[model samples]
Target: MYNSVSEKDWVEAAHPVSQNVRSDIAGAGCDKPYFEPLIPEERPDIDSPYFVYFGRIHEDKGCKTLIEYFKHFKQKSSNKVKLVLIGKNFMNEVDTSDDIIYTGFISDQKKSFYLQNSIGLIIPSPYESLSMVTLEAMIEGKPVLVNGYCDMLKKHIELSHAGYAYFNKEEFCDSLNKLFTMTEKEKAIMSKNGIAYIEANYNWKVIIDKYKYVIENITKP
Candidate 1:
């Protein structure tokens, strides 16, 4: 099974020995309570009007590039938006300033709090098998901003219509600007679209049924 179509394609083309690829993205099932949106009173002390990134703070994950792009956005945009990083810091870099706050490995509750309230989640990673962080944000009815250069990330945004994808600094800055200026109704619509997409495509029950079908077919004469 392949975690992404891009990965499957690469393996088939490069290996030449692989065949009959079946796609199986990461299953989406979680404790309902854990993912439920928190009230304003219950949210942690994160700055409002922010975009969040929840993965390793490593170069490979595009953490450094995200920072540079965000800083560039801040310089020209009038919005007081911040970028919150909520994962372990592998770069050994100091978490600095209110503009780019680093929580450095927060709990699921707090992470959910950030995700549910933020403008949207931002993923700059150029490589991914399956981005569980992106799926989790979608499951929580939030939009996402992902790297368009990554086939998997780009596919998710295009298929879901619940977010934007950027291939470079110009696109990245422009997408965030659009997100900042979006109206409440527009954002809500995106939220619903994201949730519906997740339910239809990633639900574990659906995944299990697919797995069972594959197994049965494999054992058949």
Candidate 2:
């Protein structure tokens, strides 16, 4: 089974035996997938200009890279953009800068609060089967910044036009600046696009329907 279309393609290319298996792609659904219910209304504080990064704070997840890129972004951009790091820190090294706020292992409620209000969400992981947090952010009509190396994440951004992706330090910094400078109208459009994408593709009802169809076909006599 695959969680994303990109992952399905990867398996088909990398493993010949995958052709024999009954495989299907069912993306991970978001906590609140539909837009009709709408996100719990919360006033986003305009005074605070910060992007949020949630997940395990480790090198593989690209936490270090995010910090470095943000540092560079701060140097280049005049806007006082901050980077809020959420999740447990496994690394020993730390920065004492006030610009980077580390909130280690927050509750789901707090996580949602941040996701709904932040400028955007960042997932710098080099690899991902399917980053559910990205979808969660989308549910809140929040744009995302993803690592270009992760094909699945990149595909999400491309299909939804919900955010940007970066491959290198230069690209990362450039994308950050672009996100920072985006107008309120532009951001709103991207956010709405993201929500629509999630509702159509990653909702639990849609995923279950796909799974049911696949199963019924396989079970047919």
Candidate 3:
């Protein structure tokens, strides 16, 4: 995520990415004070529910894997849950069933709205440096199903208790089943936990203060 590798610099972004990096990467990460964006709803057909994904559709993102997983899930599930892909359709060449919605890059407001309305998020990247959408979904008070293979993101998920992660079909199925079984109140509690983690750890103030202290101590006066 660094534009420069030789020397370090600080950034304050409109979203929670900087906040996450700041908290996790020590003094190297810093932020300017900013208010949190308000969460909005934009999910489609919440009654039947759908699994949402936000990113480029490519092999790295495991689009085929997700498509397969959801296909199996729909077959097993009592409800007809759909998989909504909201990004560039880089995987159009890849053979996938008709159930998946290729939304091909939605706006921020539209994405947030989708996030708000989805049952959960599914991100199964084989290798991901950092997933900003993970933090974004958490801020929206939604639980996600992620690829826990990476130590960094897995650690974040473990620490924050924001969501679940699984390697393959069986584990993913189990996790999804568990999620589907959760009562609305239980889901709400998880959402609350995610929001709290974001506020305390991913908010700009908490991140910026740490930067202030580090800069104060490192000056060449």
Q: Report, for every candidate in turn, its global Cα lDDT versus the true structure.
A: 0.82, 0.83, 0.69
Query: Whose lDDT is higher: candidate 1's or candidate 2's?
Result: 2
Better of 2 and 3 by lDDT: 2
> Tens digits of per-residue lDDT for model 3 on 1-221?
23121112233333435432432343122222233454435334445567788888887678888878777877877776667888887765744455677777767766766777788888888665556677777777888888777544565577678788888788888888877778989899889887786777667676677667667765543
Question: How does candidate 3 fare on TM-score?
Answer: 0.76
Clashes of each: 0, 0, 2
- Alpha-carbon shift of residue 199 in model 1 (angstroms): 1.2
| Model number with the top lDDT | 2
Q: Quote the lDDT for 121 in model 1.
A: 96
Clashes of 1: 0
- Per-residue CA lDDT of model 1 for 144-205, tens digit only, reads 99998888888889889999999899899999998888898998889889888788778877
Which 10-residue window in model 2 sums to the lowest lDDT?
A: 35-44
Query: Which residue segments of model 1 deviate by more than 4 Å?
Result: 15-42
Better candidate by TM-score, 1 or 3: 1
Cα deviation of 55, candidate 1, in Å: 1.3
The better candidate by TM-score, 2 or 3, is 2
Considering only N, C-alpha and C atoms within 3 Å, which residue pairs clash in candidate 1? none
Worst 10 residues of 1 by lDDT: 24-33
